[model samples]
Target: MRAGRLRGTLGSADRPASALGFRRVLAVFGALVLLVGAIAAFALTDQVWLGVLLGAAFVAACVNVYWVSRRLQHERPNR
Candidate 1:
C-alpha cells in the first residue's frame, strides 16, 4: 500500500540483504555463459543429446561450487 512497504504479513527480517557477494555472483554468471556456450557448440554439431548431458553436468558443477563456497565462507574469520 505504501511506497516502500509490502502487504505481506511477515514476522521479521533475519537474513542479510544479499546471499552472495559480487564475486560469487560473477562466478555464477560466468558459469552460465560457459554452459550456454557448451550447449550452443553441441547444437551446432547436431548433438542435442550431448548438449543435454552437458547441461546436467553444468548443474552438478554449479551445485558443487555452491557447496564449496558455503563451506569456505563458514570457515572464514569474520571481519
Candidate 2:
C-alpha cells in the first residue's frame, strides 16, 4: 500500500493539476451557467423551439461538466 501510494505521488509530482485543470473546470462551469440563463430566457419568451434547443444544449453542457470532472479527478493523485 505504501509502495502504491509512493508511486502515485511520484507520477503526479511534475504534473500538478491546480492550474491545468482549473481552466477547463472554470470554462465548463461558465458554459453551464450560460446555458441555464439561455434556458430561462427562452422559456420566458415562449419560444418553444429555442427553449428545446437551449434545453438540449444545457443537458450537453451538464454531461460535459461531468466528463471534465471525472477526467480531472483521474489526473489528480490519490493522496
Candidate 3:
C-alpha cells in the first residue's frame, strides 16, 4: 500500500484561477483564429494543402486546450 501523501500542490492551484482561465480563453481564441485562417486559405488560395495543414493544427490546439482544462479541473489541492 502507498503510505506517503503527495508533497506539493498542483502548480495551477498555486496561481490565481483567473490567470489560468485567461490563458485558456486565449488559447481557444487562437485556435479559432487558426480555423478562420484555414477557411480563408481554403477559399482564397490555390494551396489546398495549406488549408488542410492549418485545419489539422487548429484541431490539435483545441484538443490540447481541452486536455489542459480537464487536467486542472481534476487536480486536488494538497492541504
Candidate 4:
C-alpha cells in the first residue's frame, strides 16, 4: 500500500467508466417517483392490496429500465 499507487489485485488499467444517458436516467427516476407516490397514496387510503400491486409495478419498471439501458450501451460504441 502506497499513497501514490493504485490498489487492486486484479489487473485493470484505463477501463472506461460505466454510465447511463442522463435523460434516460431522469426518466427512470421520474417513473420511480410516481410509482412510489401511487403506492403511498394507496396505502394511506387503506388500499394495501393496490399498494402491493404498485410496488410490483415499480420493480418491473426498474428491471425493464436496466435491461433497456444495457441494450442501448451495447448497441453503440464510444468515440
Judging by lDDT against the true structure, name the best candidate: 3
The digit string of per-residue lDDT tens for model 4 on 1-79 reads 6575644432245333334566468659866886977768686878777777777777877777887677656744442
Better of 2 and 4 by TM-score: 2
Give the alpha-carbon lDDT of every model.
0.65, 0.68, 0.77, 0.66
lDDT (tens digit, per residue) of candidate 1 on 48-77: 777777788778768866975785476443
lDDT (Cα, tens digit) per residue for candidate 3, span 38-79: 999999999999999999999998997897677556653332
lDDT of 2 at 65: 74
Task: Give the lowest summed-lDDT range of ten residues in model 2.
Answer: 2-11
**Cα error of candidate 1 at position 62, Å:** 0.3
Clash counts for all predictions = 0, 0, 0, 0
Using all chains and alpha carbons, the TM-scores for the candidates as numbered come to 0.50, 0.59, 0.66, 0.53
Sequence-dependent TM-score of model 2: 0.59
Q: Which candidate is the best by TM-score?
A: 3
Using lDDT as the yardstick, the better of models 2 and 3 is: 3
Q: Flag regions of model 1 displaced more than 4 Å.
A: 1-37, 77-79
Q: lDDT per residue, candidate 2, 1-79, as tens digits?
A: 4543434343376433355377667768777776877778776787787777777777877777787777667766462
List RMSD in Å for every model shown.
11.2, 5.1, 5.4, 10.6
